[model samples]
Target: MAPKHQPLRTALIGLSSTAATSWASRAHLPNLLTEQGRSKFTITALQNSSVEAAQAAIKHYNLPPDTKAYGTPEDLANDPDIDVVICNTRVDKHFETVLPSIRAGKDVFIEWPIAQDLAHADELVEAARKSGSRVGIGLQRRWLPPVLKLKELIQGGSLGKVLTADVSFYNGEEDPTVLPEKLFYFTEKRYGGNPIVILGGHSLDYIFSVLGNLVPESISSQMQIRRPEVKLVDPATGKTIKTVTRDTPDILHFTARLQPSQYVVPGASFHYVFRSGQPFPGTPTANFTITLESGQIQLTAGSPPGLEFAGPGQEAKIKVWRRGSKEAEDVEWKWENVNDEIGPIAAAMQVPLYAFADGKEKGDGWVDIEDAREIARLIDGFYKKWEQDGGL
Candidate 1:
């Protein structure tokens, strides 16, 4: 790893925008500044459409007073001291906002979906390629602890000949009219829809990162929007409202074929289900489960410490069972604090950078423009298929 003191100087552009404000101000920026964060990087500049908002954010976060605040993304991108450009703009504005930085040969770390559509994402990737820039998309789940453990067990052959795989998630999507404006694109056909294109995209990325070589042979799905009366209220004024319409699918359920080999038995099948906005009364709040040919591994979270604002009783558990045995054994992992399992999450965040840094040290890096393009292709293809399915 590079010397901690020689950290990268990063200029954050467009964070004051509503789309990036909460997550950037609360999670991304703080993580970048703390010791547990990228000790080698500092937020050298803050760019926003509104200088006042940026000023308030900087003060709220207790960032260095000298951190330059700009009224536009271009201003921050052009700063000579900025070695990296962090793009946290809205889902639709990423390409436009980050392209200039790429043209200027600055490394970029942006949130997922890269853009509302693949072409825009590809345009940014092409610019990055021409400029020899590094691009890192925020698919942080790949760096989460439970996932790492699952990867180890699967790769180590602990779950010999892995069999069927299933993934499911319920993200609130029922009331379209009452939905927040910021989240409305999530349901608009123009923007990537529910789990399939959005969550499913991340899920597939993680799946491929760990499982390797799993591809979609066929996808059949049905989609619906339960709530259309939802309205988006202005954050500052609860009285103001905007009603929008969305044609995006709220539910995505599909099945895929996993190559039959020593990993499992022949004809291994994978199933995935994603739903939006459903109440979980007696069920576990959040769960990521990996059921193997031999047994199953489950990660569960409750209340204060879990990711997302889930209700109480958060815990992480692992269960194992030998093939052909009815009995199963379970083990529990440690939590770093009462508010978050962030210790493990924070540690996991370093893997990508470590991989990239190691590659850089060896005159090679794992993250590049091409990888971003490939991810874009995957996102594009998934949506195309969804559309062809008659919004199923």
Candidate 2:
């Protein structure tokens, strides 16, 4: 474990009672409470929509008795002891929740899909830059052991020259006719909660991470919403609550051509196909295939949104096939033993925190807001293309 002079004081925004069962609680809090993480980070504050909620979160999570609880984001941001502000809110709340922290010169860690649109992302980047604040975005899949190994193999020429790559993700929520009450906002485009922005954004980030410096020369995309209206269903009882019209597209298909490919050296032609949708019958959650001149590499996970939420003990399933091989070979890579106590999501969440702390001490290790801006641009490109082709 890396030595730390003192634990970094941390504050959490949008951490409420509801978070106990949400992704933030499942993936982040447990990791932070681990022995290794406790050595690096100390939870000092909690912020919620109301003081009651914040206080409730503090009690629910068994935080330090002295941990401050604040109703407003500004109050938490201005706290002198907060060294890191972690925002795990809904997509639409990110901009407002984190802006004060950035302005106050506190390093921040925000979950993926930094903002609802490119413009908001650009603004956040600018603010962080102006304040000289270290910003970390939760594109944590890149830190997964399998993903790291894949990058090493590609860079080391294990796959020879790259030929083509294809990625398909199914979120398993395609039945727009039924959504949980918490997910009702996803049906509205204005909130930027659609699969295209959330799931597609992460998919693009992971793709770029594996390709390493490959820039797209051309992009073509199509987005469509197969179900115009969706019903709200009670998650526990599986009964419909109500029906509402949905404007956001549930399906996204895109193709990109990368320049300077391995086959052509400084100028090789590389192609990629990206597809995402709601959950469908007989469809795997996610699959990624990369074909090279000499061999092929493939990765699949049960839950498609991100590897971070992969099922327990099944973070990623990887396979490799060579030209002369009779069948594909399974690749075994285990996560660090220290992370074994937590679920896959919690294990992945620990990565960004480590990077954030390392970057604060050593000056380089985490993905910043600039990376978020790039992803936002990529997502915006799809929207623009869809507009040009007329709405589906």
Worst lDDT 10-window in candidate 2: 264-273
* Model 2 agreement with the true structure over 1-392: per-residue lDDT tens digits: 24334588888887677842386787788877888878878898888888889889899888988989888888888788888889888888899999999999988999888887778888898999899777788877777787887777678886687677777777755554678877888888778767778877777776777775445556666787677888888888988889898877777776665555554244333444344444355555777888887888988877765776666644578889999989999888877833456877778777777778755442134577787677888778877777777767
Measured by TM-score, how close is model 2 to the native structure? Answer: 0.91
Name the TM-score of candidate 1.
0.81
Candidate 1 whole-model C-alpha lDDT, 0 to 1: 0.60
Identify the leading candidate in terms of TM-score.
2
Clashing residue pairs in all predictions, respectively, total 24, 6
Runs with alpha carbons beyond 4 Å of true place in candidate 1: 1-5, 17-21, 36-38, 172-177, 191-196, 219-222, 226-229, 233-242, 259-266, 285-291, 298-311, 335-369, 372-375
lDDT tens digits, residue span 63-166, model 1: 79998887766766687788877776666777777887888887777776687787787788778778877777766556455556667777777767666776
Q: Could you tell me the C-alpha RMSD of candidate 2 in Å?
A: 2.9
